[model samples]
Target: MEEGKEDLETLGEQLYNRIYPSHKEIAGKLTGMLLELPGSVLIQMLQDESVLTGALEKALKALQLEQEPRLTNKNEDEVSVSSDSVGEQLFDLVDVYNTGYSQKITGMLLEQHKDAVLHLLSDPKLLEEQVNLALKTLKEQSVEETDVSDSSDTDDTERLGERLFSLVEQLDVLHANDITGMLLEMDPADLQQMLGDGAMLEAAVRKAQAALKTWN
Candidate 1:
């Protein structure tokens, strides 16, 4: 019951975080049935190239990824089960033909740029060397160029808060760490600088961390 539902939500969260977007499509697009299946069965299919049950295959194909290979039966002595991985049959082939890169490459991009890669997945022409440059661009883009007409300290606080929130909304834990490290490495000035107070910036960072958890 209640515990089981909680457990499934946790599993869905973990699976959603660890599974690539494409593999997710291969797994019934995060359907409840996928979560309801035995962990051993899902693990078996993910790890080894096993024949998926009919319901599972149909569920995966419902998403209509480009290269879902026809499934074979284990009982057929003349035909061997698909040696290609469930991921390979679904996502990897699409990776080859569509993106021409692996999830590993995209994952490395995440390590470099946090959740930014999630947006970049649509760009098939992306190159690995361009990752850091994209991050710098995004970081710069976070700093809005608008002029605040109010000359009060309140306007300063609001403006700084807006800039910081803009950055955090795009960040995950890793990218937050990047900002933390950058902040720490820089010298400070006064209460009227960086933000209204150190506590405010700390609160913004915490908000980004909390937001990242929900994104999973």
Candidate 2:
């Protein structure tokens, strides 16, 4: 996994060097954004040059947006209350779901419905509908480029480990391998239960992270 991250960082550097030579310093930041993409998406990006270029461009643009203010003072003042409320809800959407692609998918949904974020947040059913729509859109966007359906080759344990690893990575826990190792060491039934329960998995991850922090 660490090796994979290194390869992504290397690719990110190459991407920035090729297209944004003048902004070389931001390459690392762009690379971090690229890492936020699901592992499958990253692999697809590597196999397809067009996909790679497009993803890199999006990362670059995202970085640029962060460095510049998109709204004027008047606009900020007008939306301050709603933005604050909506922003919290958006964050809850991201943090509540342990799905590996929540961050990327949420960003895509926001981009597609910039003006409707507050409106969507107003109703629970509407918010869920939009989120599902975003998830479907993402799956459709990558369905042709990536085939995630096949896993007949790996045993159930291997598949379980892969799923757990992906979820742990999304947690952004320090020493993720340590947490994964702890989870993997559980009784087979217990491990399977945790894997099926996102809330339990998240709680375990947080507990592990806290313990590791204290010990270190």
Candidate 3:
């Protein structure tokens, strides 16, 4: 029985290490996840208060280490201060994805780290540049997959282009924390024309509404 218990403990430690590279790394990841995941999941994960407390404590310690000054040897006679770590890199990646602007990595991160992605929809720092780049990439890929001909086809192409433009505009406005105002200001005909399907439009509106409620 004692041996079995020891084996279980070892397995747990191994699992923790795989999920988190280090105790400090785990702390930051858990803190970020807790801040982002739904309330119910967060509560369930924290049911054992010690688990939550320990992660927080480790994360705080890691933050302190990150803030502390470090000396670097620039040459035989000179020294400089430098700050760098794997934890910092991981945190930076998380920050980029969680800041609301879309990237190709966003979907991958969302799937792999759903708990750490909850509040992304609310970040206003995500600028139009990122959105434009992502939209441009999508448009280029879409165009490559389809071909257009003359006159009537050209008109259809123009209409499709307009719809793409509208989609990007809507995404930018939504990321800028103006979803409700945008929705209210949008003419029903324009919204329908931009979105093209009533069901999809309604679904998008509901998602925006939910995001707003979460923000509030």
The candidate that wins on TM-score is: 2
Cα RMSD of all models vs. native, in order, equals 19.4, 16.6, 18.1
CA lDDT, every prediction?
Answer: 0.40, 0.56, 0.40
For candidate 3, lDDT tens digit of each residue in 107-207?
A: 22222222233222223223223334444554664465345423343344445434543564565433322332234234334554646675665566566
Query: Could you give candidate 2's per-residue lDDT for residues 137-204 as a string of tens digits?
Result: 65564564246434332254456667887889888544554456456545556778888898988898
Alpha-carbon shift of residue 144 in model 2 (angstroms) = 23
Give all TM-scores, in the order shown: 0.22, 0.32, 0.22
Model 1 worst lDDT window (10 residues)? 81-90
Q: List the residue pairs that clash in candidate 2.
A: none
lDDT of 1 by residue, 56-106 (tens): 454444334323333245645554322112223223322322222233232
